[model samples]
Target: MTNISGALVSLALVIGIGIWGYKLLVRDVSGIPVVRAASGEMRVRPEEPGGELARHQGLSVNAVAAEGVAAKPADRLILAPKPLDLTEDDHVTPAAMVATAQQDQAAPAPVDQTEIAEALETGNVEELVAQLTAGVAPIAETEAEVEKVVATVAETVAAEVSAAERQVAALLDAPGVRHSVRPRIRPAIPAEVTQAALTAETPQSVEVDPASLPAGTRLAQLGAFDSPEVARQQWDQLMTRFDAYLADKKRIVQEARSGGRTFYRLRAMGFEDIADARRFCSALVAENQDCIPVVTR
Candidate 1:
């Protein structure tokens, strides 16, 4: 707190000194007008007119003409009008007769009132309307030619589509890109040679019969399966996976039943006894295999 107060005091003193130096040494550069001592003739900034003039003449503006007069109430209220043009404007037959007086200077005798009413109200206004509209010529049907032109355009479009379809069909039905080219077929190998080559690549596995083992031979069961075929397939897969350990062992799919569930046991036969089966199963178990040693009764 003491250091802060000391620093603030020092800052205030520096600012005060700077302001004193500016006032004492520097001429006033602020926009406020300063009268110089050298100008001896100019006294006070030339005195402005004391108060506002007797009549203020402000900036000129575009104003409306002063000749327009206010309208009187009687003049503003619309009159009933001459009442003569009303009859002329309300009905058109009389006005059209008067307007076409030159054309009617020779024709149009006075029509009978009863005859006109009967002719006009005879279930349709056709005769009266026809008499009224006799002079006004109707606009002619110019669109017929336009419709004929549109029909011609549609026929042209259809013809173009058929031509395009024929062109595409011709392109598709043209001869093959490699028509004259012939393919060379490789000769087939003889069945005997194929068999020999296959035999050389993959030697045939020996099939073992469970009955051929000695009397006291024991079997190591790999797993119990639902069918003999599944057991055989499992044996093949296990032999493939553990070829080094189970290669010499013989596969046997033995069917078994407990109560109702009849299953086949995939067993490795050709073991001399339980001791050999146990050793074989121990080796498989060491490699994370499931094995059970069983004595074939």
Candidate 2:
């Protein structure tokens, strides 16, 4: 009897769903353009063409010009403000926080060097020490408590180590613990570079002064390589590829080391300051090349 009742309920649900779906799919409002289009009663309005169609539309758009009623260009400008004759040469890019321009700077971190010095000069060791150590009070000098503290720390460490040893032994004796040890890891060899690079003495990196170069001069680094020869080769290839932009630039190779491996950086000099160098890098980047603007003092 329960199964028959459930079947009746399911049949009623199916009938209700069919009726709702029929109304949703078949019933439509006449106001909607999509419904009107489906009934083949909608009209497609063509866009107004400014050419021959304008004449056929019963109005000559150029009737004033056809009747020789056109005004002079100067007469039109008489009512409007005179425009300035600007060229590409008049445009200039702003230096947006590139380290060299000294633009868009945040507040600097505060220091108390003078205050600390004054305290030290006045022989106020306590105040100086407190400031230097971030308010950590010094141990009292009246009693010999260092030995006692050391002894307590040593005893606590010994107890902890003994407990750790016992736990480690228990873990080692368990069936899941492996007795064998893996070999120690060795350092992998560095990447191989050009033959000349082996004997070539790498130049030490030194900070260059911005004023050291002629006025309106900046430097740019193009790539980093495993050796000086590779860096030089990259510079040569770049000169050939981007001769139009880099014709006046001089080649520079800088040496740097990291993790016991030496690297040489390829650079170009003779840009019209850091901005010019950045602009040059932007052009190179647009062509899928990597570039970095070198900062100087």
TM-score of each: 0.30, 0.29
Q: Which lDDT tens digits does candidate 2 get at residues 1-297?
A: 999999999999999999998787766743355543366547765565444443343233444445433322332333667899879768763332112432343443454789767886899878666555553334573144556555666776788789999999889888974677876666466667766545333333233433355543467888889987887667667766787877777776767788998887777787656788888987787667999897643
Badly placed stretches (over 4 Å) of model 2 are 1-217
TM-score of 1: 0.30
Clashing pairs in 1: none
What is candidate 2's CA lDDT for residue 53?
Answer: 40
Q: RMSD, each candidate, Å?
A: 35.9, 35.9
Worst 10 residues of 2 by lDDT: 94-103
Off by over 4 Å in 1: 1-205, 211-215
How would you encode candidate 1's per-residue C-alpha lDDT over 1-297 as one tens digit per residue?
999999999999999999998886655555477686774665565455575464533212211123122222343446686755557547654221232233222334456688778886775577766665565544453366456656776776788789999998887789777345665665555445544333222223465666665565688889998987887777767776687877677677767799898988788877766888888887677557899998866
RMSD of 1: 35.9
